[model samples]
Target chain A: MARLEETTADGRTLMRQTPASAEAQTANATLARKMRRRGEESRFWWLVPTIYIIFLMLPIYWLVNMSFKTNQEILGAFSLWPRNPTIANYMVIFTDPSWYKGYINSIIYVVMNTVISVTVALPAAYAFSRYRFLGDKHLFFWLLTNRMAPPAVFALPFFQLYSAFGLIDTHIAVALAHCLFNVPLAVWILEGFMSGVPKEIDETAYIDGYSFPRFFLRIFMPLIASGIGVACFFCFMFSWVELLIARTLTTTAAKPIAAIMTRTVSASGLDWGVLAAAGVLTILPGALVIWFVRNYIAKGFALGRV
Target chain B: MERTWNNKAWFMVLPVLLLVAFSAIIPLMTVVNYSVQDTFGNNDFFWAGSEWFDEILHSDRFWEAMGRNLVFSAIILIIEIPLGIFIALNMPKKGWGVPVCLVLMALPLLIPWNVVGTIWQVFGRVDIGLLGYSLRALGFNYNYVNDPFDAWITVIVMDVWHWTSLVVLLCYAGLVSIPDAYYQAAKIDGASRWAIFRYIQLPKMNRVLLIAVLLRFMDSFMIYTEPFVVTGGGPGNTTTFLSIDLVKLAIGEFNLGEAAAMSIVYFLIIMLLSWVFYTVMTAYDAEQ
Candidate 1:
């Protein structure tokens, strides 16, 4: 897959005089070439994938390996794989109300945030892609600026703002806080997808006497279904994995799994097994999400619209 | 067409504008307010008039944190971008290996930020963790908890492991977009490997590279969760970046004015850099 050659047309004159030296050099070159070609043809393909897989799997293997062992085992043993695997740690996380509720809270806010961001971003992206109005360029750039705003800087302001509005500890506050970044990203990605659709389609629909809403819903929406899926997936991923803003915005009722996980470590000691179990569980939803969206991620980027 | 151009199109965007304004503008105003005033509980406030800004601007602590953030971002970019591209180059463009490779690369990106920190925190212990235990068994003294250098290395390595995949995925998308004709052309021209990458692939990947660079820079600069989870910005503020320090000042210490000033400064820095990136990328795109 990665091969290159350099052409030297003028080398024919030099090649004629250096046949003796060239014959020996060519013999060695041919031998080296044969060896290299053999390497590529035989095991090179397998080697590439194997290295990548091992690189990717090591940390996850370590996490799962620790999760199966007892805390004492984790502290005392250094096994590559668990010797006597146990499910006691998994039970701790699944059975405990505090831990379980964290997952529920995380889902609630992430779904809410994703829904809000995608719904809002759809029209905005459409407008930016299709219309050239006053300040449209400026507005589009301004939206992207929000995506660049650091969540840490907004933490204090978000907390104070939510608290003042009596929205602290509510799922809405967390959802709203996430929109600061998610909505902008949704708009950007969706806008790219939307722009790729020819404007003549909209013009054709208008010539046929179709209204704006009807044209958008009937024609434009179906054309960009995959784009919407891609945008929603990104919105879900960012909102799902984010911690700093979610932690700052919620205290009790809406605490995400991330905040709950942080509490697992205490002055007494780290709960290695339970923590690993929680970590395992934390990755499950994202795994499922990426699986569902896996096909679209590459395809979406392949369009080169975003 | 003229009728479609009416202001009713503005209504299409109204929901987003309202949502963003409520979420972003209101809090921004609050930060602006706090940056210029002193608050002493029970809603009591006194006019400080840029004193907080002046203090933050002049403080060695702020400068140090800024320096650390810049260095961390630079290191992450240096490691991630090329490594990601190299990995992408090796990735399978066909067959079952494609999905397997992609899913594996995405595994780290799936884990929540704090959990990532926790994973490393446990994974780095000399007594209990595999990494620590194995390294110790192999005759290395590495202890991230106490050694400042180890702590920095641990944090940087952890981040690279987590985020480099994002760049890989982005670059892979760019790579796959190139037409087969380009490769055929290169082959016919007898182009050298370096020439192909320099003249063809690199130029084609520019758009995605721009996106990758900007996203990575912004995220690295704003990094808080992983380091906070692993080190708690500890061993005496060695890993304390601007975000961690802002949280400590605002929530931990309850110094609203100073925190607010710091946040504004933080926001400005991010905004300025992002604007520069956007302008440069867009201008380059236009030129192309």
Candidate 2:
């Protein structure tokens, strides 16, 4: 299923030669390319993934198409595209305080959670990667056990705890609450990336009269920039996408857009167009983040485990 | 890489330890506390002493829900794993197609879980949805809201649409990292296509596939929002997995003690299964 591209035909025949040394590595590459190029599998195989992608996009496309149509057009017929496209649904979200505030509220807590998770996770991850502290293995595994804990189990407890602290209906409450799941994940991923960096760098930095904090900030932090980006992206994605805990923890003031969406089924009826617009809008922030980190999606997100 | 034995590293980890404790540990303790005590409204409580646990274990409802959760997770893993590997294997190795595929494939994943549920809900409506309308036009009685079989199919397909990208991404990462020399040596040996995949690709993909399977298993086991939004655990409780049942018990019916007992047992089941998976896979990896 892998695609191989040949830049030139010059090395095609040399690919048949038996490998002997460093040059053999290039010959090996050439042979691999030839195997791929000479395979009888038709290019029609590409259609499998293309068709799969199209299938994946169809529902999302429907969501986007519905967002552009009036509610009448949506319920009136199953049109593949909007007969008359209008941005009225989007206009509703932009103009209404309740609608737009959901976005702001979601962003505020998501960014807060991402920052808090990554920040606390950074030092913890470094410690795990660089040292075998007391109960390190057990502590590491216990952190992961939190990741496996269903939010359903914590939904009521979290509400009670946060309310006791008078943090109910607040963004920080949701942010801090999300740290339960995100912090463990951040630590795990970051530790994987940090372990890939040799210990010699830390020793050398210390020898140069750099204090631990300064050396960690100047040398280690930059070294794992991609890992941090990946970790932040994951933390952002989880915090942003999470609904049950966020819904339980907040009421009106800090309600997430996902929970706000439930209100679409009001006294009148379901606002399919407006709800679709909100759904499409939710995809935007994540899409923008993914675009910036697309280059790292394949590498950093693998967490160096693969 | 060797790690130094420095107990002082705990200082660096203190902040996370405190944060997770506040978030995870305390709430967990509350669940534990509630599990052993029966409470009535107005903050009145009585000692129950494992009564909730005994009742939950003996209850047919809890057992039924556990059975449903297991069946759902098993089916999801069976379908998603092979399909994810196939899709990943088929993906373009390089060029512009790579980024385009990655972005479009990941779109479903980035959408909120509830939104995914909502999308499927609307998309499966016979009156307004494309899939429902098309299926009706093709002369199949495909109503998700009212039919048990249809509801199961809709929920499973929704999960697949939502999560298959995660497996694909992980497998693709494993695929790209394979050095060209491995494939070259396979070619030099005149290995057949199946032989190449079995001997070269699958082994290289072991670690990522392990992560994919474990994540998918745990997440599928605890699934709530998407199916909850779609089916509301309806069609005569056919879709009511453990989380859905637990929520109904705790929040809807206010059976806090039994719910808490069920929660601990549910969590143990996940942890035990995950440990087994991790141990078995790592042991196999070691032998390999």
Candidate 3:
């Protein structure tokens, strides 16, 4: 029987060795202390990531500072922070239809894309992880190739296809369009996570007389909850930030925030403060998503092997 | 873990297949159709056959853009991968710092591509932007608009700032998954710092690093909006990457057939290179 226990360096079985020898116990304690000391020695290296993060945040900080100031103030002076900080830029975005509607349109499509990608991916990922079929490797590779295809290559064709189907300027159009890339990604990541689960779990569930859907939803899903979260986060992130296809597929009704921002450079010139505020608002949803999925984000990055 | 042979698995994958086919295949076929036919107006297309392909093949402009793309991807990979790894290695293994670092690092990745371009475009402006203003104040002649060298550096630096966090996040994920037991084993064996990284961390990080390299390569190769917003491929055609050039030709000039041919060629190059990288990396991964 394979007991659920982690073995030590010695040949003795960890679960059975309840009364371990004093020598072995002492050795284990000292080994742990050594590891702790090593961790302490490396603790000061935290400064490296700190400095690097400061470098990363400086440009963003400048943007936030600029957003709070008037356009004249932004162009006239180079202050570190806004001397006369104002929320008028944000007010302009909140009051404007073209601006705020961009957020609504972006959210609708991104959510739809996330749900669709993750739902379709779960079954396919389970299939890839637990079973083999005809042309499985080819199918998997082909799906990934879609991920590699540049959005620019598809821009014209996508415009034509969506317009032909009369999907132009609709949320579902961009939502379905993003599936080209997101579905493959969701499948790949979820497959990695699923492969980490033992096949015996599925077999055990089946032997218990549970149907596949019940087993998957009630048992397998909760097990790989982080994986699902990671997949959804990625799908959301990709769909949310993508502008080329969204720009191509939408004219007015579903123009994304990113596309709307581009129109800020009008005949009058760029609206620096308002544009910065919109940029800041655009970052908000992703930031919120990242915060919610922070743990899974790291686990997801590890491809859920851990 | 051996997967069982089950033809019935097709049922599980059907939805994905249908969805992807609708989004991918139809459009790809259309691109193919356009590639072989020359369209003028009124939906009139002449049988151009391979003439457009031959023209694109012979065009010096296409070759130049391809060359620029290759150099840009190479430079980005060389810089971001190592820097990302180094940052990940030094990151706090545990504590409040982890979430703070991860979130802050991820801020750039979440920003839309065009906004990222705008941030740098404004940030690098001598009149209002902090970076350009500070540099000029320090008596340096820095301008991304007129100077090709400055444009290249700004673009490279902007990309590094934007995407290194991705590599860093991936590497950090790999780093954390490594059991403390491995570090303990290395410590007990009196391993040096370099040996610990060489035999343990580096090998552990190989999978995520493979992903980082491939993603960064493909994305950087397809880069358009950022440079387009900042330089407008400016000061001349110094930064007009293949995608931007294709867009200009197809949309701006309306040479649909020639642009479609160029797109196909561009797609083929990416596909072939990605296949090579994937096979080589995954093969090496399996070996270890």
Candidate 4:
């Protein structure tokens, strides 16, 4: 006899007969098993995520801790929190155009990349979802291969390519370069969501005198708006977090916050407090994004295709 | 699931093709061009004809970095995949623990990769940082800057902190898809705990686990930003991975030919490995 008590993820108890089993489970045994499971459930299962989350939060807490203290306090002594917390670190970022502009520069390019990637990816994703064009399968695979291409591999070439176009140190250069991976990702995700929509919707829209563009925008897009949102969130996330290609593609004018932070680490004496503050600020955009798409994140992390 | 054979569907794909060509193809072509030729000064090029590739293939530096990357990926995969599954299994099925776990766990994944490195670099500092200070007070000779072993541990821990959430989320997604009836059946059949897990939950999580493994391998193999920011490939090259070594060659030393050659090799290796993994996983999946 085999006990299947662990099959359900949440450890709920129920009984059914498998073909190979000779006899049904006894009610007494089932009751006993249920009691055991309830005991097991209450025996600190929540502590797993609780402890894991505490581990995850500690480093972030340290960063936040350092950000609030003065540089003197950071180096002078160690305290669990701050002995004297100040907004001076944040003030430095807000006041210094060089510091504040990094955030602006990062936002500008990230938004640009998200818009460009999603805009172009929409039609492409639609084609992949609905059509059997030449080399479609191969083309889809080829696009994904680009996502796996390391940013380091493209860094030098991207610099030269953008320099050739007189686009070096422009927001568009970073945005376009980031499209190398983001466009493919956007297409993959949007394609997954589009395929889930029934084909009859498209046929019905088209038959109702809805031209392709109008249908895609007005009728179809609204149907898969959440997919679009998920795609935009991912594109934004990747472009925002990525530093190598973005750092390589721009020098001063379009320098991202990441570049600025690195430059501070090298160019000036270390300003631990301000850097910590900048680090804390960078987490905000992504946190906000995840909060909005919290429900879709699991599916999004799976690229929405699963 | 039938798709129409409309030749005009090509028009819909045109934008992506053009954009990708502009971004990926042109730059890649430039790298290929540089790899095949030598340049001494401005506007001077002569056919090197795989000479750089030959040199890179024989160089210990290239091989050592590749070896480090492979080992690093292997170690992280071994640590992360099981840990992720364990955490996912213990996660709350419903209620506030759901959102709390999902959001907080996903936090590190959202942070800039560079910042993830910086967070560790500071957090591990012996002077002002909690982790380093605690280790010092506890009388350990823990210093990442001067110690190779410590550096590797810091990098690995940082990676776990940043990315284990991905595996957990993916596995949880897989776990939630399983119906309750299967558990009831297994219970009635008197299946053992290990037997139920081995036969049921593990099988259900197979697809996502495959994705998690493949993704974890690829990302960890290509890992550069976080480790670079943390260790700067320091402590006598103990931490230098392929990407950092390639960057140092290409940008730091201005060794374009070698770097470009190494780039092509690196790209090919990932493709081959990923292809192998994909085929193996899909075959295993089909059998079950």
Q: Estimate each model's TM-score.
A: 0.90, 0.94, 0.93, 0.93
Q: Model 4 clash pairs?
A: A2-B190, A2-B191, A3-B190, A3-B191, A3-B192, A4-B186, A4-B187
Candidate 3 residue-wise lDDT at B222: 92
Q: State model 1's lDDT.
A: 0.80
- Per-residue alpha-carbon lDDT of model 1 for A1-306, expressed as tens digits? 001000111222333344478676575445434533432345465676577667666778889998899988877767888899999999998899998999999999999999999999999888877766766767767777898888887888888889899999899899999999899889887877777677788889999999988988999999888778888888888898899889888888889987888866764456778888888999988788777666446434322243
Model 3, B1-288: lDDT tens digits are: 788899999999999999999999998888889889986699998898999899999999999999999999999999999999999888876678888888999889888888899889989999999999999999999999999999999999999999999899888877776765677688889987778889998998888888788889988999988998889888799999988998888778878888889889988887887687668766885786
Provide the lDDT at B189 for model 3: 94
The Cα error of candidate 3 at residue B212, in Å, is 1.6
User: Per-residue alpha-carbon lDDT of model 3 for A1-306, expressed as tens digits?
Assistant: 011112321223342354368786667667756765665465577688888989998888888888999988998877999999999999999999988999999999999999999999999999999999999987987887888888888888888999899989999999999999999989988987787689999999999999999999999998878788889998998898888889889999999999988877643456899988988888888888788877556455434433
Number of the top candidate by DockQ?
2
TM-score of chain A of 2: 0.89
**Tens-digit lDDT string for candidate 4 (B61-177):** 999999999999998999999999999988887688798888999999999999999999999999988999999999999999999999999999999999999999999878866
How well does candidate 2 score on lDDT at residue B39?
A: 74
Q: After superposition, how far is residue B58 of candidate 2 from its true place, in Å?
A: 1.3
Interface RMSD of 2: 4.0
In candidate 3, list every pair of residues with a backbone clash: none
TM-scores for chain A, candidates in order? 0.82, 0.89, 0.88, 0.87
**Alpha-carbon deviation at B157 in model 1, angstroms:** 0.7
Model 4, A240-304: lDDT tens per residue?
99999999988888999988998898776479999999999999988876888876676777666
Question: By DockQ, is 1 or 4 better?
Answer: 4
